[model samples]
Target: MSIQLVFLGTGSGKPTPQRNVSSMALFRDGELFLFDCGESTQIQMAKSVLRPGALKAIFLTHFHGDHVNGLPGLVGSQTLNQRHEALDIVGPRGLKRWLKCLRELNILWPGFQVRSHEVTEPGIVFEHPEFHIESVALKHRIETWGYALVERDRPGRFDLEGARALGVPHGPMYGRLQRGEAVTLEDGRTVLPQDVLGPPRAGLKIVYCTDTSPCAGAIELARNADVLVHEATYPGGDERLAHERGHSTAADAARCALEAGAKKLVLTHISQKYVRPDIFLEHARAIFPNTVIAQDFFELEVKRRDD
Candidate 1:
């Protein structure tokens, strides 16, 4: 299966005419996972191909207004829609308290189950049968975390010719062998999956880091990732300003990707002062050739290494 990333809002701090704040939607197997619900995220979703009802989880990097101002409105809308599926919200320590405050104020009253996970310490935050997510503490102004979504390794390809040669019938027995289960033939011969399968294939890995300066956490999360979505809030010359604000320059983001051996780098969380992304792209490409500037509504497909 392929994973697609949609940049809903790429601007940092506040909305501009060309861009909104920080929000991104990751679509995998018909389910949607949101990272950072900035202001007007729902509006952006409406403009894009994303359906709010498909959203299964929301992950907050920090408590910054530009990162989470849209949570209440989004949840309220789901309540109005009478969504029945449970929703998960993951964030830093104050996440649960803030959600509770919203409930008390009637700002958010989702009829569906809302599960909140507060990241007191960074590690594996969420897990599924097919994939898992790991969180790492980032060097931001406040408590912040970077996340890595890693798909589990898939079974190897089945060798149809070998299976046929091994006296396996063209039926359920073939499927059992393909699933790594041994099958016994009518003649009392046992065939193992290893006898008719190639080596396992590695799964895709996507890392997302924002509102942080150059740090080990970002590098660790991005290690060997297929795609690293990092914040580039300032240009190369403004490194001091970027560091002071707990943000990264394009060059810093590129260096992180290079050190982490990431396959591709997507620069986002742009500052409003920049009218265009030409300089950012130039700076990052100088350090890492495989770098792209993320724009609002931009979509990227994270493909497996073999693909």
Candidate 2:
């Protein structure tokens, strides 16, 4: 599984010359999953490795302008790119109305198909052959959500030594044993799956969250995550601002990571007031040791490790 996170935009609400807004892309098995299509996300992604036509879905956490202003342009550009694949748009309330208005206003760009899903609860939203995505409702100014992508567990590796000892050659019999089946050879010898398979391996898990105050829902979504991408919209000592705006501070992000037992935490959606983003890193690191302040175009390699 090719699991990686591409930070397309890291800046918060306002756009700065150095950074854009809240946008992230999760690449897995040649498919690109977009989270929060902030303004200029398409332009930023065009310069990155992400191909617009290959986007399988767009997940919106909220309806804030900073989080979803780029939807029209992204959808329009996809149409121009001659993409015929259906796009899944999942979000909180009003998602259907927003897309409906877009289709009505931008009738010329109706070449592609879009399916809108209004997320109501916290559970698995989408599942495919590779992975399953779940949502957790967050406490924000609006009906926001945090997402967790859990990859399906793969079959255990074949045990060649065990198979050979059981008189099973490295052929179709070994394949059957690996598939958890009992195989009978021409000599009437039986081989069980346990004799030809190692221990089961865990799958990868990535958690993404933004635009919410420090809440238990966010922590629940991030529990035991391999890579956690949380919004740190403000620096330390800005608790008042964070509470007022339903945003999170650097310390808040770290607390979420610590509570969730995440292996690695990436802080993003930074406010524009601070010229030095290093300050956010310093504050976050003070609480959670394994923390990285995300930057635009920064890529993080994700791997699944047993605890």
Candidate 3:
């Protein structure tokens, strides 16, 4: 299955003429996961290919206005649209309290179930059949979390010639073998999956870290990630300001990517001070050659290493 990333809003603190606040959409197979629903996030979704009804979960990094101000409006809109699928909202501590307040204020009266998951500590927060999500505390002024979506390792390709040589008839038994299950033949012969399958293939890992300064947690979460989406709220020369403000410079983001051995680095959460992203790209590419500056509505398809 293919995984796609859509940058809904990439501006920091506030929206700019060219960029919105902080929001990103991750489309895995058919399900959609949103990160940081900043103000006007729904508007950005409307303009992009994302469907509100397809959203499975919203993973927030913090409670900053630029990171979570659009939650109520988005949930309310889902109610208006009559969505029935349960939506999971995962974030740092205080998320459940904030959701409770929204419910009391009638700001989010969703017809579907709204599951809120507050992360008191860093560990696996959400799990699915094919993948799981892990969270880690980041260095920020407020309580914040970085997330990593890791897919489960898949079985290796089935060797049809090997199966045929083993006298294994092709049918349901082929599927069973491909799924790493042993199958019993009508002749009382037992065939293990390893008999006709290659070595297990590695899975994909995507990490998202933002609204934070350079921290060990970020590097740990991003280790060997296929793609690392990190915040670059300042230019290379503004490291002092970026650190003081609990944000990261382009160089800082690149260094984290390099340290984590990330295959690709995408710099987002751009400050409004820079009208252009040339400097940010230049700074990041200096340290991490496989770095790109994210823009509003920027879309990227993360392919497997084998592909």
Candidate 4:
């Protein structure tokens, strides 16, 4: 019923003394989903209530060192920590080979399951009973991708008042009506759920993008997201630098959020040049006022507010 985002690290490739690279953990219900396991990610997860072994899946945007440095360690730690379930890792092509090489050189953690999936096109990457993931190609120096997590819509609450008005007493019958089923009363009268149940509500959507410039695919993948976590490696002042490096600025990220109709924007992958993040946030807020600068150890809770 709640979506929680924990910021493990927010700095870009060149790490500063205080900030590590990009890493984040998303928790919805009881499952934990990870995005970009940069260096020190294991340590970061240790700081939170998230158990590293409980990570249901990991989605890597690219093979950039900063984005994937902690993968081997994370996998290795699962074995060390004694995990029982398999870990699903979904990313761009060559992911399997990369992990294979790492395992050949180092030890392959034996206890947990680690499945590697290489995505070549845009579509669903991973799916479970509760959630699903999809991605789109991003514009970058290397082959990179972004992801969107779509949760399945849950059933709506039952209309207890409507049921009462229909002469349905409060008991086990109410539970059956809540499940969208008809209940037979002791009086031999049938009560339909449609008269007592409200319409099903839509679920929340979370999208993430890293190490990319402005691209149309990125916008489409992030459409109508409750939270869009996009990279703002630089502020808006340096368009040339951003273009040269195939990176996005704060303004670029903000525009993407506005274009995608995202309700909130999380600006991350911060450049080390700026000590104070307010400058980056200020530029982004100029366009997308809902923008917030991602900070280490910061946690954002996603929930719907009454209109």
Candidate 5:
């Protein structure tokens, strides 16, 4: 199974003629996850192939309008469509306050069950059978966070030849053996799982760190990630301004990617000043060769390294 990522919106503070705000989606096995719901994110999703009803959870990186202004609209749309499924949302501290404000403004679905988790410490904020969600605080103007979605390692391929050689009859027992389980044969012979199983394969790791300058927490979360989605809200010439505004420049993102040893770096949260996004890509590629600027509706399939 491959993890698919779609960059819904890639603009910085406001929506420009060529780009929207900060929003992205990860889809796998029919489940969709929204990361950083900026303005018009639902509209962007509506324009895509993803089903809004399939959204399982939302992860907010910060409370900036460019990063979280679309939650109310998204939730309201889901409610109006008669979607009653529970929606889980996780974010840094102060998220509850914003949620309460939205509820007071009558923007949220009163009947829809929405669970919110406020992450204050660096730890596992959410866990699923397929992946583990971890967050770390980042250096920013406000309470911001970077996330890591670590997929679980899959079992090795089944050795049908070894199973047959061991005189193991073909049946449901093969399925059991393939799952790293020992099974007994018709002749009372016990076959170990290692006899027919190869080594477990490593899982995929995806990290997202945006809206912040170079920080150790972001580096730690992004270490060795298969794909690192980071912000490049300014050019390298504005390093001073980038640090002052708590935003990362294209060069800063590249430095982080190089330090973290990320496999691929995707520069998102683009600034409107640069008409051509290739400038950011060029700056980032100076240090991190595997870097690209993100565009709206940008889709990538996160495949296993071995593949």
Candidate 6:
């Protein structure tokens, strides 16, 4: 039940001398999910703790080259490595057609089956037993999306003494009671699940948003998230340029986080012009103190809020 995030590349547009591009990896329950695969993302993954073969799915915010150019390379390497498991690729509306063109041109040839899903409207796109995912349309030059991954609530703490006091045998019946099921003993006594279980524990929530201006949809998607990974593509004193480019300034990202009531904000997609990224942090920290600029190879373990 471990959850962690690794910023493989944090720079905007293209790879720079200091940063690679837009890419991040979220590993949960041993399955690795990618955020955006930019140029040389496989190489960046090799430099970090992510494994190419362990990739379960990839999520693209938009079709910008900086956000999705390295997809072919990564899939090819997975094919070369003899991967046969089905892979999922989720993105905006034109993604399916774009991938079709890539396949028609032989740009991407996977040894395994690949399923591409186009997210036209905003809602839950993927669901799993352990966790579920939601997406919302974001405002950008092109159609973009912000994602929220929320783990399911876990079972409450089991009281072993309470189970034994009910004269329940040390077997599957006791396990059933701990799992919130009613059990009956040979003496015709019935034991309820709540009698041996405490309150349910809350789950972890992580929201990721990039390549967009500060939008209401993004803020709604990140409401009360444990961690908000938003893009800060510009520093202060460039408000017009940021809006023109459909990007967010550091202050914009901070305002989004503050309005969303997010616990922590991690800024990525840094522009190369900012040789000194401290200014971005300074501007963001002015509004939100729990803010940090994400860098390549940055890793963080997202734990429960109570933890």
Cα shift from native, residue 75, model 6 (Å): 0.6
Question: Can you give the lDDT of residue 68 in candidate 6?
Answer: 94
Count of clashing residue pairs in every prediction = 0, 0, 0, 2, 0, 0
lDDT of 5 by residue, 196-227 (tens): 98888889999989889888998999999999
The residue ranges of model 5 lying beyond 4 angstroms of the native Cα positions read none
Q: What TM-score, over all chains together, does every model reach?
A: 0.98, 0.95, 0.97, 0.93, 0.96, 0.96
The TM-score between candidate 2 and the true structure equals 0.95
- For model 3, the superposed segments whose C-alpha errors exceed 4 Å read none
For residues 63-161, write the lDDT of model 3, one tens digit per residue.
899999998999999999989989999998898888899889887777999999999988999999999999999999999999999999989878999
- Tell me, what's the RMSD of every candidate? 1.0, 1.7, 1.1, 2.0, 1.3, 1.4
Better of 2 and 6 by lDDT: 6
Global lDDT of model 4: 0.87
| Candidate 4 lDDT, 38-131, residue by residue in tens | 9889988998778775688899999899999988888888888778888899988999999888778766645766889999999999988877
Q: How far out, in Å, is residue 284 in model 1?
A: 0.4
lDDT of 6 by residue, 1-307 (tens): 5589999999998799799999999998789999999999999999887878779989999999999999999998998999999999999889878888888999888789998889889998788898888899998999999899988888788888988887888999877987788998899999999988888888888998998987899899999998999999997668789988899999999999999999999999999877788999999999999999989999998877543
Q: 1-307, model 2: which lDDT tens digit per residue?
A: 4588999999998778888998999988789999999999999999998878779998999999989998888888888888899999899889988888777786436586788889998899988887899999987998999999998777788877777787887678766777688998779978778777777777888999998899999999999998889999898888898979999999999999999998899999988887788889888999999999888999987865642
Off by over 4 Å in 1: none
Candidate-wise lDDT, in order: 0.93, 0.88, 0.93, 0.87, 0.90, 0.90
